[model samples]
Target: DHLMLYVTNGMGEGIEASLLTNLAINALRNARRAGIPIADQAALADQAVYAHYRGRCYLSVLLFDFDLTNGRVRVVDAGSPQLLRLRRGVVEHVGFEAQLPLGMFEETDYVAQEFEVEPGDRLLFVSDGVHAVASPKGEAYGEAALARAIQSTRLLPAAEVPRAILRELTGHRGEAMPDDDALVVCLDWRGRPADR
Candidate 1:
């Protein structure tokens, strides 16, 4: 089994990264000791972030736990809009329903969900920056754009997936730099190359 937790402050003003890292690490330790599921650990992390930062910063996290035996993927998502699956020739969004971001509420309840992945499946976990792009018409390049990008590269090696998405994101805005911090994570199942 493997667990992946991702947290980023996204170039927010007046933020200290060390504090976030410490809180994440502590929450991870606590989760390990408590022997709880991803949902409980997410709630615990929410409390830690809330108690420490008090909502002065924005936090988005995606927790993924993968079971090697059955190819089951467990997800505990907190206020993120970018979880995608690309299979065959179609791409789909599998993100969690809207939930409170960490540090926004002390008593927020987080839920863990699951997905079944196959050896050739490609999973993408992106930060909000990828969707925070806008055009001259004031429309942000959204999920549809992302799905198209993923579909175009779905059959290639994983190393090319994230790069294609970034290209599509920048393509939406022409020459303008991304207004927000961007992150793209691509995971390829057996025999696929893993890329950022």
Candidate 2:
């Protein structure tokens, strides 16, 4: 009935980040298991993280709740990248306003925006690290380059889309490892499993 997409900011490193990431994952998992509303899941996780880390660790998350039955998606964006939706060969941002990163404050409420998707639609989620990849000339990879890459590779298999995007990033930034962590995820909607 529900599928979820989750990504955390990889800005933090070492033991503290590992522990904080685990806490966040559990918080979100427990909230969903308890049937918490999609809109409030982030807030619940935020409270748990904040209470535990006390501003020592913060997270920028992109939480997506996918309703397979109805072909709708509810997204809570907390300082993550703008979601890109590809439909009929055209790619565009889904247009949701993002709130502050979780664990930054004592009480923070996250609002989710809902949208309908169809078969053949592809959703892309790129991390800040991906955007921050810099060229030898010190230029960031940026959205314009990412969009162009997506457009060029839209026809590839879903599993290969991320690879292609990474290739694009590498092409721009050269062969060196990026200074920050990079994550690129692509979801191709092909209706429900039963339908398939």
Candidate 3:
């Protein structure tokens, strides 16, 4: 069992952003510690944030729980970037129905979706900062560019993928630093040897 979380308060490194981050992290940690089912974990976190911050603060989250024994991953998305999955040298989007960010409402029921992963499959998650990087001409480095970037560097080692993707995004941005914090996480799924 493994829990991976990517959360952003949508505010850039301010005191409020720090508080919101801590709050969300605690809520998520508590939920996982309590053994909440993967499908319901986001809802539990949502309730916590809503109760404390109400409409004042909210979060975009991509939470993934890996059940290694079964070779499955459960994902709960709240207004984060759509996850990318690379398999057989092809990059594909793992689409979700799209849900509102956490704490926007009193009781937001986040839908958790499950997918099966095979050895050699890679999953990528990025923050909006990566998506929002723009060129001098105002053309944003969106999903198409990101997909191409991932494909172009698909041969790199798993640990190098994030930096490689950032390099691609930076090239698109020219000399400008990212206006927002950028985060990229890559998961290389190598099934347990016992399962093989």
lDDT top scorer: 2
Q: Candidate 2 vs candidate 3: which has greater TM-score?
A: 2
| Alpha-carbon RMSD, each predicted model | 4.3, 2.0, 2.1
lDDT of 2 by residue, 123-179 (tens): 888887787789998999887888888999988998999998987788898877678
Predicted structure 2, TM vs. truth: 0.91
Model 1 lDDT tens row, 1-196:
5655554442253347556656765785688567778778878877887888777654677776777767787877766647788777668888566666666777789877888788777888888788767976678888888777887787778888778878777777887756776788888777333566
lDDT for model 1 comes to 0.72
Q: Which stretches of candidate 3 lie above 4 Å from their native place? A: 1-10
Ten consecutive residues with minimal summed lDDT in candidate 3? 3-12
Per-residue lDDT of candidate 3, residues 1-196 (tens digit): 5645554535446898888778878888887889887557778778887898886778888777777776777777787666788899888888876787878798888778878888888888888888778998899998889989888877888799999998888889998767877778887888877734
Cand. 3 TM to true fold: 0.89
- Candidate 1 segments exceeding 4 Å error: 5-18, 191-196
Q: What is the model-wide C-alpha lDDT for candidate 2?
A: 0.84
Best by TM-score: 2
List the pairs of residues colliding in candidate 1: none
Taking all chains together, each candidate's TM-score versus the true structure is 0.82, 0.91, 0.89
- Model 2: ten consecutive residues of lowest lDDT: 4-13
